[model samples]
Target: MIVLDYPYVSKFLVESVRDLGLPVLDTPQVRELAGGVPLDYIDEIEFSARLALGGKVYTNSENGLEHVLRCRCNEDLARQVDICKDKALFRETVANLHPDYRFLRVSHAGLSGLDLSDFPVPFVIKPARGFFSLGVHVVNDLADWPATLEAIETERAALNAEYPEAVVSGAEFILEQVIDGEEYAIDVYYDAEGNPVITNILHHHFLSAADVSDRLYYTSARIIETWLLPFTEYVRDVGRECGFNNFVTHIEVRVTPEGDILPIEANPLRFAGWCVADITNLAWDFNPYECYFKELRPDWDAILEANKGQAVVMVIGDLPPGTDRESIGSIDYQGFQSMFSNTLELRKIDYKAYPVFAFAFARMDEPELARLKLALAEDFCRFVKMK
Candidate 1:
């Protein structure tokens, strides 16, 4: 029997597992007494590194036995990719790999004397590796490049003085033409056998314009069949060539006006936060953890089967100016529910507050979702309390 520290496991994940009658071991005391779960002692980053190295682990915690499932093949692949604070490399990599794909070419602030108004509106500007929206600016003209570049430089200087380690000295900022399209995430999951199966596709909406972080919705199987499969194949080939197999990859993409799908960037990690949970509830009728356990699969066919013609609504805050989480009080969940009971699946009661919160998610009825979506938009109007 394996024992593990409970603290290392996610509470929501553990609870879901516990609800089932599966055999397991957990709790820090028991783990401490029994020797400890196989990998609980390692820090998260270290754990991720070790797992990437083809490590196989078995341990139990406050929840039960959790198999640190990973592909045994590509353990040392992490060492191959050069990690640096260079944004030029990012642009170069994309251009080199997919020359035909529409992309924004970026030049350094000092190097390029391009006009913003001369180009086009809604182009993106940021330091190769920028934080927040500090060094990021969006302008619609080539004429505005001078001012925007100035803004970028000022922010860059401030960041260098304040958080030197976060920015590489003499870092070059790049301005790229932003693509027009809906944003989505492709969640890559490797099965126990080492095959990369796209678990879910999600639509991402942002918490705020400044941050540019997004809320997500599970992609219907139909959407995947129509749009995602080809892209999936493309990435699969690329990832395999890059020696990335048996791990999760979050690829951000946009669908263009020409109906072309273009990948913006890819994260070599799982989508952090409740996003995994959100995708789980709407598409699978169970969240990611439950899918991990393969339990309570209410609609196994529907879950795995794509394009069952369903949709999920993600609610996010467009908070009024000067208001924050502490300022609001006595929020009414019931009142909110009365507005959109039909499609409501999960509500994001509070997501870190401030500029990016007050959101709800509704699972629109599959093959029958339109009416519910309308109901939600009409019925839901209660202000979420800040405090």
Candidate 2:
């Protein structure tokens, strides 16, 4: 049975697995574990207090299931921050863990010694333990620190009152050094036993010109070369060191200003998004969602070699309310089906759903590939219009 986390992530997984004709266990598997089944039965578990009782729990190495649950990493890269009651430890650990990483600590009061007047802004600030971009602010001028800190403090106080348990152990704000470089997301898979295999490299594009943005604007496979393979290998090594395997990891990274790839964050047991399988299926001839459930691996070399010119474009836009299928024209079930017979692979297209959108997996034969990619993306987005 396929188990999932919360409903948002679970719905997509359940639907995709069902589409592949598989039975799914919809209940939160954590409940089952609490009820007395062994820990290994749980495929993935997020961090929580009950499981960490007295700081030890049983884990099965054979299936690499233990890594699926949140552990030390949740506290921060240094294993110092506790998801519950350890904010001060978190700030201290994060700073100590990777002093080289771009880090900035924000607070109700400005962080001492980080003057913004200096050129080449080096850091950013936010609530120490904020979510969904709350209280996240960037400071370039030392002059702006006080104002920014005051606003964050106000927000932090409100959040603490509402979610005392969620508050960080320390009252200090989040300070992060900006990692300057291009951003790329690596889709990685670990064997049931927890060894990683690089699947694909997808470039994420942001609609906003600003440097700090959370929501993903668009994604496509732009380039993959032999040099990047080593980068993927390094990520695997890091994952192994962390004691996690048998899951999908969305590792965000930056091509450092010095031409080195440095990891921004590693999500141990989560897919980048529900759309990953769709991107791989459309751009390449393989399906990751299928791979996960069926325990199969696609020949990456062959797929890359065969579909060298193909790319997948994710439409970045919002769907208004009351939108319906008629806006996009009749679902050309037959015409749409015809692409698979050709070289094109259309990933998941939900015409009947809100925020109506479709992705075109197109192949081009010339150096004019860039132009063709845009044309195809436009057609795909237009064809699935939102009212």
lDDT comparing candidate 2 with the true structure: 0.46
Best by TM-score: 1
lDDT of 2 by residue, 1-387 (tens): 233332123223344554665433223543332343222232223233323332222111111222323344333321311221222233343343355554444454455554545334646665555432345666666667678666655665555432232432225655666666777777666665666766567665443334344323223333655434666676665555554444555566777667767655544334454343355655665666667656576686666676655545443222332445565554444443333324353344454442434333444443544443343342333333244
Superposed by TM-score, candidate 1 places the C-alpha of residue 368 at a distance from the truth, in angstroms, of 8.0
The lDDT of each candidate is 0.47, 0.46
Q: Which numbered prediction scores highest in lDDT against the true structure?
A: 1
Q: Which stretches of candidate 1 lie over 4 Å from their true place?
A: 1-11, 14-53, 56-91, 100-122, 130-136, 144-172, 190-195, 205-218, 257-259, 286-307, 318-339, 343-354, 366-387
lDDT of 1 by residue, 1-387 (tens): 122332233334444444643233333454343343232233434554555565433232212212232322333433212111234444455564556543344555453555443444566766665432335566665667577667666655555542243333336556566777777776654444445556566766443333353433445666665655666675665465445544444566787777766666554434323334445555556555444334122344545565366666555433443455466664565665454445454343342332444455656545544444354333222555545
Q: Which ten-residue region of model 2 has the weakest summed lDDT?
A: 55-64
Candidate 2: segments with Cα more than 4 A from true spot: 1-15, 19-99, 102-120, 126-136, 150-173, 207-209, 214-222, 226-228, 274-277, 318-387
